[model samples]
Target: MATLEQCMTALEGFVGDLAARPALSGLDRTVSCRLTDLEQVVQGRLVNGTAQGMEAVPAGPSVPRADIRIITTSDDLLAVTSGELSFGSAWASGRVKLEAGLRDMLRLRALL
Candidate 1:
């Protein structure tokens, strides 16, 4: 099992990549990543195709209301980062869950 720290690292790297994608350009939205197994939440915002203000916060609505929410386990997170698992497969298999508004959903589909 991966630790929460490891998951956070991987998530940051993943988000960094996502930030550079053209699809995210000019988008300004809050995103929350809720790690179920880790019992933690990491929050950030997308601005001009870059993620900013990302940090772990106590799990709750105290963080910004998310336009995109990603729910998954630490192990699965590390797997995806290490390429031992695919995001699409994990999501399809119910190991990963994503919640977002309709526009955000359409936007997220181009993420991975």
Candidate 2:
């Protein structure tokens, strides 16, 4: 099983590759992950085609930022990273929870 750091690294690589495409250059967003049963939260910003790690500060209210929140167990993370789990199917099956604004959700769908 991959550690959270390893999983994060993989995700970073994935996003980096995706951001390299000319069509994806303008994407800017924030993603927050609260791993199931874990106390740590990972927050980062994807801006101007680069993902910059952000301080793990609590989000303020009324901020106009597209936020993607994911809550899943460690096992689920492993499954997702290994391609053994499908996010759409997991989301539909209640294995994952996603909350986002409408436009954020749409942009996330396009990016992913």
Candidate 3:
């Protein structure tokens, strides 16, 4: 049971790394990360590859539609940050789900 704070810390680091990548420098998008196990969603807007306003949203179906969506369990989220699991592996194994448009997918190839 990973807390939202733990997930936010890990995600800030991940997004910060993505923001620093030259390959992602021109990318801008909004993202939603859903922790299904915890029934929580964190939303953020990315401008020039830097993420901002990342915070937990009230659990609901109605919210601003994100350009990218990431769905995963809270335990897996914790595992990835704790070095107990690899993101690529988890994604490949269907433990993590990433939904994005083709263009965004191409731009995000470097991170995912």
Candidate 4:
């Protein structure tokens, strides 16, 4: 299994790449991630530049932001990151849970 730090690094890289995508430009959003397996919470905003830590997650109009909460098992992270697991599947299987307003959830789906 990957260490929590390693998983965090991977997530950071994934977000960074997402931010760099042209289609994602000007998409600002905040996603609070809880890695149940790792027992960690990562909160950040999607922005133009890379974010290092929680504080660096952007929160501005250039990137409209919304908060997202994700709950999942440890092995689930690996599955999600590897594309072996889909968010819809995990949610349906009760492997992942999300708590938020309907609007926020929909916005998150688009941002993420």
Candidate 5:
């Protein structure tokens, strides 16, 4: 498992990468990454091609679902963000799970 700080850093980099992509310029959505092993969630909103209000909170029923939800372990989160693991492969292997509306899924598939 990755430390909380490490996971936060990885997510920061992930958001930075997403923000740099022009294809996502018009995309606006709330995103949450649930770290299973750590039992925490990193929540934020992706707007204007950037992520805002990124924060980690304990995993529980009180954590509201976002427009885009990602569930995975902390180490896997780091690996995916760092390019050590491909998102598609991870999803296929059941290491990562993604949930979203059909339209959002289609739009995100092309960029994520």
Candidate 6:
């Protein structure tokens, strides 16, 4: 298990990388990462490959769904961001769950 702060830091680093990816260029979408272990969701917007205003919120119906949704544990999030676990492996093995539209999925494949 990882602490909320640790997860936030990991996500920040991950988003930093995401912002620099040419594959994500010109893509704009809202993203939510639901951390099952902490029962929290980190919400943010990806605008032209840059992450903006990311914040953690409680997970519940009150939270509106984002265009891109990711469900996983804090540990898995840490593992992926730290390169201890590959994103493709995590998604394939069910450690990570990604929900997005077909177009977004195709664009994201380059990131994996």
lDDT of 3 by residue, 1-112 (tens): 8888889888776666666788778778888889898888888877786888899876686877799888898888778767789878888999988899998788778655
Better of 3 and 4 by lDDT: 3
What global local distance difference test value does model 1 have?
0.81
Q: Per-residue lDDT of 1-112 in model 5, one digit per residue for the tens?
A: 7999999889977876775577667788888999999999999988887888999999999999999898999999999998999988999898999999998787778544
Q: Cα lDDT of model 3 overall?
A: 0.81
Model 4 residue 22 CA deviation in Å: 8.1
Which regions of candidate 3 deviate over 4 angstroms? none
lDDT of 6 by residue, 16-80 (tens): 67766898888788988999989999989888867888899999999999998989999999999
Q: Would you list the C-alpha lDDT of every candidate in the order shown?
A: 0.81, 0.62, 0.81, 0.61, 0.87, 0.89
lDDT of 4 by residue, 1-112 (tens): 5677666665676567656666656656666566665556667777654543552222233442335556665577667766788767788788878776776465446433
TM-scores of the models, in the order given: 0.88, 0.69, 0.89, 0.63, 0.93, 0.95
Whole-model lDDT, candidate 5?
0.87
Best by lDDT: 6
* Candidate 1 off by > 4 Å: 61-64
How many clashes in each candidate? Answer: 0, 0, 0, 4, 0, 0
Stretches > 4 Å off in candidate 4: 14-25, 48-66, 109-112
Better of 3 and 5 by lDDT: 5
Residue 42 in candidate 5, Cα distance off native in Å: 0.4
* Residue pairs with clashing backbones, model 2: none
Any runs in candidate 2 off by more than 4 Å, and if so which? 14-24, 54-66, 110-112
**How many residue-pair clashes does candidate 3 contain?**
0
Give the per-residue lDDT of model 2 (tens digit) for 10-94: 5665446545666657877676656554544556776787767843333355333337676676567667656788777777788
